[model samples]
Structures are given as C-alpha cells and as structure tokens.
Target: MKPLPSLDVLKTFLVVDQKLNFTRAADTLNVTQGAVSRQIDGLEAHLGYALFARQARGLALTQQGALLVAPLQQAFAQIGEALAKGAAQSGTLRVKCPTCAMRWVLPRVICLQNERPEIVVEVTASVSHGVDFSGEQFDAAIVFGTPSLKGVSTHHLFDEVLTPVCAPELWKARRGKMPTPGDLAGKTLLHPTRDRRDWLRWLNAYGYEGLPSTKAQHFDTLDLAISSAMQGLGVTIGDLSLIEEDLGARRVIAPFSLCVPSGAAYYLVYPERPAPSPALQHFAQWIEGEARHTRTHLAAYTKPIHQPIN
Candidate 1:
C-alpha cells in the first residue's frame, strides 16, 4: 500500500479547502503562505492530482479534492470523539452493578443524573456479584458481598436482609390471612441461585426446614427471580432493603414479617487510586446518602431474633 500523506499535509489541505485561498489558509494554520504552498504541492504529487485550481478570484477545489474533503472531515471528527472518550473529562461515568441491586441502584442513579445534569451516568447490569477493576473499564461498581475486597475502597450500602415476598394477588389468593412459615409448604418457592444457598441460609436462621426440591424454581439473578415472583409465579426470598419501593407500592408483600440478616451486604466499590475522579466522588457521596435513607426505611421491618446467616 502507498504510504498515506502526513497528518500535517492532510490538515493543511483541509484548511486550504475551507478558506479556498492560500494566504488565508496559511494565516489560519499559523504558517507562512510559502509553507502552505509546499504542503499542497507535496500532497498533489503524492496523490498525482492537483487539489486546488488557482482562479482569477481566489481558488477552487478540483474534483479529487472535493471527494477527499467529506471523508477527511468525517475521519477527523471520529478521531476527536475517540480522544474525548479516552480522557477522564468526557462527562460520562460508566458503572457496573449486579442485576440484583438494580432495584435499589437504578432509581438512585436517575436521581443523581437529574440533580447533576453536567454528568452522565452509564450503568451496566451483570449477574456477577463482583468486579475485576483491573480488567474492566467501569469508573466504579456496586458490588454485593462482604466488604473485604483488597485494593479497592468500599462504602457499605445495606445488608442482604432476607424475607419471602410474593405478589399481592398471590397472597390474596389464599384469602386475607397472612402467610406463615408452614404456608410455604404447598406454594411454589423461587430460588435466586441454582444451589438455593440464599433460601437455605434464611430458612436455617428461622429454624424452619426448607421445602421439597421438586417445588422450587431457580434463576440466575435475584432480580429475575423477584420479577417472576411479582408476576405471581412463586414466592422468592428478597433483600428487604432493595425491595422497599416494591413493598411500599404493594407490588410484592412480605407476609411473614420475619427479615433474616444475611452476613453479606451491598457496597459501592472502586479502585483505590491516589485521587479519585470527580464523577466517582460525586456519585459515591450521593449513593452513601441514599444508603443512609434506605437503612432508615428498613428500620420499621421486624428483624426477628435469629443467628446471623453467614
């Protein structure tokens, strides 16, 4: 392949194309008119075509030069975009969050965007509960688990408070009576994990043996399982703090009133840099305040005396 002309010569051609006059183009490029002429001459020789025709009145673009103008302009515009995206001041904050936490994280993120219109927040939801910051391009992530991850700063959001929740229609199907631990015997049980670890933990804490394996439905993420339950598919163990809005709206009802605190919790995590980006810092502060508000909301729920489920 023939070597492309240098960026300097290509840029000179664009300036000349826009101004249509060598003197003005030279002035715009902060170069001498003779230098501009040499660049154009060199570019024409490389392409074996004259780009500009010297007219009695200024200059005119040859057919070949006109064709190159649009493509060159587009190429330069794309280069600018790539450079802006590589810089930290692009005004977009990319965040990764577990699918289960979207119920809690999504609304808060919308609120943050509304309050601070200057910053754009982009969220990626995944089934994985943790992130490898070294491999990902996210500015920050909301992680679910114990806050012991090394090389990252963590801000505790809320505990994984477990409780069985079902659609109001499902609960009302059994009449106005609230459900008990024994009521789960015949009802379909939704397991968030394939192994049913969350259900087992909560059941163990309540001193209640779990239901039969044949009556269970499994999902990859708690959010999916909870969504299915809200459709009256079954009763799923929900993290009470994350589902406060649903509980308040009566989309799902926690009839048992027994919230078991699993040892793990959700946290806002980011790499421990010497100086964090302003966008990350701003979001961290906002989310921490929101978390405090969530904790207050969860205070009313009855956390029965039970051993903490680890």
Candidate 2:
C-alpha cells in the first residue's frame, strides 16, 4: 500500500466533482478559485490519474472521479454521524424545525429545558418544510408535510388547519363581525407560498368561486407571512394549531371561522436504522405528549368546514 491523499484535497475533489466548476466549488467552500484548482491538481497527482476532463464549456467528472463520489460521500457521512453521536452523549439533542412551526415548537423547547434540565434541545429553524436525514446531522426533524418521508419513524403532531388571520385592530375595524369572502376585496393578501396555495385552498373550501384580485405579498415561510399579518400589513392564512398563542394573546385574530385542513401535518421524524439516542427518545416522548394536548385542545377549532353558512 502507498500513501493516502490529504483529506482536505479529497474533500475539495468531491466538491469540484459535484459542481463541475472550480469557481462555484470555491464559492461553496469559501475559498479562491485558484486554491480550489490547486487542491484538485494535488489530488489527481496523488491518485496518478486524471479525475476531471476539462472542456471548452466546463469540467466533467471522469469515470475515476465518479467512482470516488459515492464512497467519499458515505465515508464523510459516517464520520459526521460518529461525531454527532459523540456530541449527543453530552446530553444535547439537535432538532430541525420548519420556521412556521417555530411558533409551536419554540415554547415547548423552552418548557422542556425547564422541566428536564439534564437534556438540552437545540432547534434549527429552516424555510424548507422537509428534512433530508442523509445530508442533515439533526437528531430529528419537525417536518411539515405528508407522512411520505421514507426510512424514518414518523410521530404525527397535528394536521395543519388553514384560516385567514390578521391583527386584532384589523378584525375590530369590522365591528367584531366574522369576515366574509367579499371582505377581502380591498385588503392586501399575504401569501405564505409563492403560488398562494394556502389562500386558494381556504377560499375553495369556503365555497368562494373567484380568486381575489387584491394586492398580494408573498413570503418564503408561513411564519414570516403571519408575522407580517400581526403587523397589520395584510391578512394571511395561518395554521390554527401553530398560532394558538397568537390568537390567545390577540396578536393575530382569525377573521374567518371556517378553518380547512391543508392535508399536511407536522411530524417528528428520525431515522429508522441505528436506534435513536436516549436524548432523542426523551424529547420525542415529551413533544408527542405536547402534540396530544394540542390535538385535544384544538378539536373544536379544526372541525370539518363542509356545512353551509347560515
């Protein structure tokens, strides 16, 4: 056996192989393009074969480079997993949560720390609604979609119930009356998704035939959109369960009584293989209990909206 190439060079090779461009790989690695070129050159020298074929357009991964990609990815993943397990032993559980669910998960995380000072829960909020356990190092994730995620044990939290919410003052302006479809005429609509799926679903479920032609603002996440609504910017659709505190505190009020199910629910998801850490187990049990409480409390709020308006 000969000598092994530097781990740094190998890592750089992987990045360049994935990107197929030194400038983009350097951008991702936060290094200069020249530095990335040097690392690839050194790695190819050590391997005694050309890893990338440079063309007029760009670089393509040679057969040899393609072969190294999967193994390197798996090796790095295993190393990361080992490091994460070592960190977990220190009594910390890292959890990934969608920004929209932060309203629901953050308070519970604080309460959990208060109740169980021995366990520390670190929550990372992201705009993405799903998590990729393969690439991500989180002990678990609070995913906000259907239970279609594979190879993970999913613990159902609660189904998302969508309804229009706005600042208390906005609702009060209507003389404490429940807002009808026509009330949305002049006000700007805040959309959580670019396609405005949430508002569309709620309107369709409420039996409104035409889409509102009012000015609209789109946000990357429901949390931002709801936050905008609380500032009296406009009305946005919100998940009834997640905004329970906002409703209770009168920060935001649901003007429409008909809250329809969006067919997606939040789930506590973790890998099925390599049994979960003890810290994960404890947090999972605690959150599952909290979710149960929420489901029971919001029972009336999430009732089916099929009945006709009086």
Candidate 3:
C-alpha cells in the first residue's frame, strides 16, 4: 500500500491549490517557490497521480488532487490541534564516534550525563574513518575533521596533537636517554592503519628521510594502537588530546619532547534545523566544557621540545 503524504507536503499542496500560484504559495509558506513545487511533486509521487495541472496563468488542481485536498487540509488541522494541546515528546539522541575519542570523550560524556542527571546519550564507536551520516540514523556525531555536509552544523571540538608515545618500560630500556627519531629503526612502529596522512607528516617533519617503514603490529584505531604501545609492544602515534590521562598518569612517555598538529581536528556535527534539541544542546555544551578543561590542564604539563630528534 502507498503511504499517505506527510503533513508538510499536504499543507503545501493545500496552499498552492488555494493560491493557484506557486509564487504566492511560497510567499505564504515563507519558502522558495522551488520548495513548494518539490513538495507538490513529492505528494503527487506518493499518491501516484498528478496533483497540479500546468496552466498558462498558474497551477490548476487535477481530479485526484481535488479529491485529496479537503482530507489533507483536515488532517493537518488535526495534527496542529494535537500539537497545540501539548503533544510534544522528548527524543533520544544517537551518536557515533571514532576509536580515539571513544576512550576519553565517551567516558567524560558519561560524566556529563551524571552531572546533569537528566540527559541521555547513546554512543557507538568504530575504528573506521569518515562516517557517512547521510545514510545512517543519528541525531549527531563526534567525528574527526570538519563537517562538510551542506545542511549540517559543526562545532569545533579540539585540535589533535600527534607524538610518538610508548610504555615507560620501553623508554627505560633505552638507558634513560631520549632517542632520536632516526633511532626508531630499532623499535617496532605501531601504526594506526586508518590514518596515513599524519604518520607521513610526522616522519617528514623530523627529517627522517630514510626511516625504514617497518611494520610491527597494525591497529585500525588509536586506542588499540596506543594500547599496544603501552604494552611495550611498539611505538604508536598518539592523539594527545585523547591520551592526556595516559600521559598524566605516566603510563605512556613521549619519547621525542615534540608534538605536531594532526592536520585535521575533531568537531561536533549535527543537522541544522529548527535549532538543536535540548539533549543535543546539553551534550554539545558538555563536550565544549570538557575540551576546554583538557586543554587547560594539559598546558600545565606542557614540556618544551628538545633539539630535533633527527
């Protein structure tokens, strides 16, 4: 069975049918005439009939459209009445993330929920890069890099800092000496297979022209790659923004005293329409606060870069 047209489409159909002019209908709806035409097209497609007849002057309703007009108008009136009678309901927010943020940001998000004790946030994480929200169902997403979607809104979360990090024991085995970047020849390189750009940039920045790309253990996510690094397994490129806890706890040591920006940044992205929901707004504010606190706390522990590791 065919689905009934939505209230918005029905409303548009009624307005255009009454005005007999696309321009007049658009003006009344405060939308472009193109929008009005599209809505009518959608409605007609849904009903599998032509809703408007092309006329020299303007639009004229087809027989099928005339039949649907009264019922659709009445249906929209009922929907509006119900809304006016306090039929609003709160909705759950579904969010997705990359593996890096899952470790730090996700836990902090739980704290945000506890602090407010009112909002609910459902989070999912993956090791993949560049998730397509267009096909997926999500109220918002905390993703790497800027949001490029046309209708999407973005909030800058934080910049990424990449540095070589390893377990304390691994560095201790180095005779308590900070090794140069070229010295990485002896250690295993735990690479985040998903992100290639930063790894290359890091190597190029330190002038490690001949640094042999030896594959030790490959991980798809920073969380896993860094975990392996912490196990004295290999050195991984750590996103400092996500690994502040590990760094502060001395679980990991930055061998090279220098770190560089990861080129891309984290962002809070959501569809922009009628403003954000209360839950989404609270989540956004909470993440913003968390990022601020993280940056501030990190500045206290910021160490100066030594002479080049090359």
Candidate 4:
C-alpha cells in the first residue's frame, strides 16, 4: 500500500491552498508559520513532489499539486460524510428512569432500537434525586414524579399504582383468601428502601391508624426485591405495570383486594432550548405509545384491587 498524508498535513495544505499565502494559512489555523511550513514539507516529502513553487510575492501550486487538489477536496468531503454518519450512530441519548420502571422500560427500548438503529440510548436508574441535566451528560431523561428543574419541557408518561403481591404458593397456602391491609400485620413485608414512604402513605389512605410490623427485609434494588417477593420470601408492594409479565406467568399473585395510588407518575424531560433531534422526537413518541399500551394491557388483565384516594 502507498503511504498516506497525515490529517494535520492535509489540513495545512487545504488552508494554504485556499489562501495562497503561508502567513494567512497560519493565522487561519492558529499556528505559527514554522509549523505550517513543516507540515507542507512533510506532506511534499511523503508524495515525493514539491506541492508549491516558492515565489517572491507568495506561493503558487505546482502542476502536480494542482492535479492533487480536486482529489484531496473530494477526499475531505468523503471524510466529512463518514464523520456525520458516525455521529448519528454513536451520539448518545441519555435517559434516567426510576429503578422500578427499568424492567418495563428496558424491554420496550428494544422496540425503539428497532425503529431507529442509529441512535444509542444510555440509561441511568435512580430514585429521582440529584439529577443535574445541565451538569450531566444526559440529553434527555424519563423520571418518576415531578421534575424539580425549571425551564425544561416535561411530559407526563403514566401514573404508577402500588398493589400487594406474593408468590402463588403463598396465596394457595392462605386458601385463596385475599388479605386486607390489616391482614398484613402478621406477614413479612419486603420493602424497597426508596419507597419506604409508600407503605405509610398507602396505609394512611386506607384510614388504618396503625398496622402490626413484621420482620421486614429491605432491598436496595427493585428487581432484587421483586425477585425475593416472587420466591415467597414475603409480600411486596409492586407496580402493576412493571410486574405484569410475572403476574401473567403465574410467578406472582395479588393476594390483596386493596391497592393505592403511589402519588407519583413518570415524566419525560428535555431542555427547552435547543430543539430536539429527530432521534429524540422519535423516541419520545415511541415511549408514549408503549406506555399507553402498557396501561391498556394492565387494565385488561389485572383487576384493580385499590381505589384511588380522593
């Protein structure tokens, strides 16, 4: 293979070719004249030909250099095209979602990828705290509850409702009798540390003064807590939308007829300034559609066990 000119040399050549003056090219490139001359020298050495004829007034392109100009211009144009394509493929669409919704959102993200394969989606799971969109690398986020940031566009995704869930065997052991909130007094309660307040809010909404506290196991991760609940370690408050697959597969059963509004909903947030990219718009539309489908699916299959608080 033939040796190639370095990008630095090519860039210097292009600038000097355009200006026809070494000083002007050096000024444009923010480099000293010495550096520019060295780059041109290296470029000419590699090609085994003088690119420019030194003149008293300025510099003139040699016959060989004139011949190379058109091809180098085309080469640079092709390089630009490749760079744009790479940016489209690798440009990140950063997103943040609640830990509980990660399971539901990740699977649906596969569908988004099918629709727009060029954009990469980066997801960060958190409990909706300390999200700094301006300081962080995120281009967009899907957060639960209200976004505290001002001057950003926010779209409501869906309301999350909590329901009591346990393994099917646990339900069978109880002889198919659904437990009320009071009935949970004697049973173990698997709790997500982030949603600890949810239990209290739910109990308060039910008009229950105080319920018996059983042996409680706290899990930092929603998936781990859900898995532990599915194994009949204890009953857990679950988002019906997230656990629909486990419910459908009979891995878990709702042993309570009571449910409570979680006082939180999902939101899609982005900067209000710079208009969104085509990729961001496409993803937002797809996610909203999927969320609607999830709601409809939940309504059709899962019975509402809890009434909304007034």
Pairs with backbone N, CA or C atoms under 3 Å apart (clashes), candidate 1: none
Model 1 lDDT tens row, 220-260: 88999999999999999988988999989999988876778
- How far out, in Å, is residue 178 in model 4? 4.4
Query: Whose TM-score is greatest here?
Result: 2
Model 4 scores a TM of: 0.63
lDDT value, candidate 1, whole model = 0.82
Q: Candidate 2 on 11-75: residue-level lDDT in tens?
A: 78877877899999887576799999999888888789999999998899899888999998788
* TM-score of predicted structure 3: 0.65
The lDDT of each candidate is: 0.82, 0.83, 0.72, 0.73
| lDDT string, candidate 3, 1-310, tens digits | 7666665677778778879999998876767999998888877777778988989988888887789877765665455434323311445667888778887877787887778776777788865434434334566788886557656788887777777888988764368676677667777888877555556666776666644556566776778888898898978888888888888898998777667775678888876643577778778887888888888877643455322222
Give TM per candidate: 0.69, 0.75, 0.65, 0.63
Lowest summed lDDT window (length 10), candidate 3: 80-89
Full ranking by TM-score? 2, 1, 3, 4
- For each of the candidates, give the backbone clash count: 0, 0, 0, 1
Candidate 1 TM-score versus the reference: 0.69
